[model samples]
Target: MAAAARLAWVDATSGVAGDMLLGALIDAGASLPAIRAAVESVIPAAVALSVDEVSRAGLRAARLRVEPLIESPPHRTWRSIRALIEDAELPEPVRDRALAVFGRLAQAEGRVHGVSADEVHFHEVGAWDSIADVVGVCAALHSLGISRLSASAVALGSGRVRTAHGEIPVPVPAVLELSAGWQVVSGGAGELATPTGLALVTALASECGALPPMSLESTGVGAGTRDTPGRPNVVRVVVGTPVAEGGRDELVLEANVDDLDPRLWPGVLAALLAEGASDAWLVPILMKKGRPAHTLCVLAPVERAAALREAMFRETSTIGVRETAVRKTALERTWVHVPLLGATVPVKVAHRDGEILQATPEFDDVAALARKLGMPVRTVLEAAVAAAVDQHLIPGAELP
Candidate 1:
């Protein structure tokens, strides 16, 4: 089985900036030379990266500065950036990540200006520093092998900040566009979150909340250009591997629906999951006065509970939802793929004390294999389990 994914959770409690993100990665042990090289490989301008150890609000952090050789930089469009990334010699994942971040920025700007993302002209973020910051962050994340990105509630400072469009309000139009469904709070004065930072985080972070279950490895603080009054204007990134905790809290959102037709159950479940529900299911129940109904249940991280509820309300005929805090425990699990009938069948193995406890083929994979092989799902499942055993995926263990 492939090892579990390593994650980096950006703590944007103060705020996030492009330079601040790069500085944080540098502080977290990302190679400065490597990041500079990657950024140079993708941009036409001669890029200079300087990383200095600086103290912000009495807390030590890394400060990254980008100096470009070119003068009178030309404004760029989404298409041009895409072409630049596609033609660059950087790693594929890094290129894709940088492109994704920029794409989000373009999309937000496009939505604000009523243009398509591909045709949107990046007025401010098209500059050299913006490009370098986005690319360097992507390269650093790739170098650290961070496959998953998460964040805490973002903190946006108060007041107006100057942009290409003259004086604009704090948490600019682009920030609002990028933050449609995300959690953000305002703190202090001045522009804390920039379009570059907001786009990067919203585009990349798969989940946002309090620190998830992880074993701590390293933490880095990236300082913003200007220091805030009380706290250091910085964004912190925490890198670690996910581990199953003994006991954890989750929010359970439930809604009883008897009026909704059963045909739309799949769609509702899919919507809930797409909206960040950890798990969504329906259970048959009898309501008051012997009325038959189905209880739609959603288990989600508390941070995403609101989004999940909204999805449920939109997709199901549910007027009210019950939210409850729940404690849950789960075993350490690993998934391995076994080749069967010209298809890769994923087998879930649950373990305790590093010993193989039970091995079972994923039901979805089994059903797909059954359809492809013209056999029963049980038959496909049995074959996959046998193949996994033959491959010694779990030594001295029986299928459960």
Candidate 2:
């Protein structure tokens, strides 16, 4: 079996930039020398990366600066940048992640400027410093062995800022386009989140919300240029191994409804699941005045709670929804294929610490196989279970 993947949760409440994230990763013990080497492999002698301790609202953090060495760094197109990264001698994971980030940027810029992604010229992001920042962050993540990444709702500014296309709103068009489906807020008065930073998060982060439950490991804080008065203008990264046996953090959203058509409940539950809810169901309940009602419950990640809550309001007749924080302990699961009626059926194996707790055939797969073989569903399920047993996939059996 493979080792468990490590997790990195980024706190971008104060906002995020490529440089800031890079600094945070470095402060979290990612090797800066390794990151610099990876950056140099892509753009040799084009820029310099340096880090120093800085105070952001009295909080000490690492500040990474990327200084351009060339007098005039040519604006690069997405095609050129792709080729540059592809041609560089970097680790496969780093190259793939860097490409993914730049791909998001190119697509966002193309959509905003009404041009094809390949033809879109990244004016500010194509500069040596931005390139170094992107490459450096990717390299840092690779160095730290971070297999999973998540972030919080990004902080955006309210005021306008000068860009390659003159003055635009705080969240420039590119940033807005990249921020689709993710949460944001008017964090401050200036551009708190940059296009590059947003691209990095949207492209890489698997989830967004509060800091996830993790086995405490290490924490790093990366500072921005300004030291805001009340808030720490810094990005924080918490790294740790996921708890193998402990419960994971989750949110429970419930609403009681008595007026909606009972037939619509299925569709409502489906919509909630489509909106990122982990699970959505209904429990029969008695409401005020003894009205027969169904209590709709939704299980969701903290990052998805907002969208799921909105989905509930839009899909159900409930006037209000209640949310509660919960923890869920689940078994580590894997699948094994068993031959049934000349076709393979999947069996779910649940285990902990390499000890098998249960092995159950997938009912849907069994049903499909039964239909295909002109056999009874019960017959197919029995055969699948027997096959699993024959293969030593039963409870109390050791997980090889």
| TM of each candidate vs. truth | 0.65, 0.65
Question: Tens-digit lDDT track for model 1 on 98-196?
Answer: 876786687678879899777988988888788899999988887777766788888888888887879988878888777766789996677888889
Q: Kindly give the stretch of ten consecutive residues in candidate 1 with the minimal lDDT sum.
A: 301-310
Report the CA-based lDDT of candidate 1 relative to the real structure.
Answer: 0.80
Lowest-sum lDDT 10-residue window in model 2? 301-310
lDDT of 2 by residue, 15-91 (tens): 99988999999999999899999999999999888999999988999999888887999999989998899899998
lDDT of 2: 0.85
Clashing pairs for predicted structure model 2, backbone only: none
Candidate 2's error at 51, in angstroms? 0.4
The models' CA-based lDDT, in order, is 0.80, 0.85
- How many residue pairs in model 2 have overlapping backbones? 0
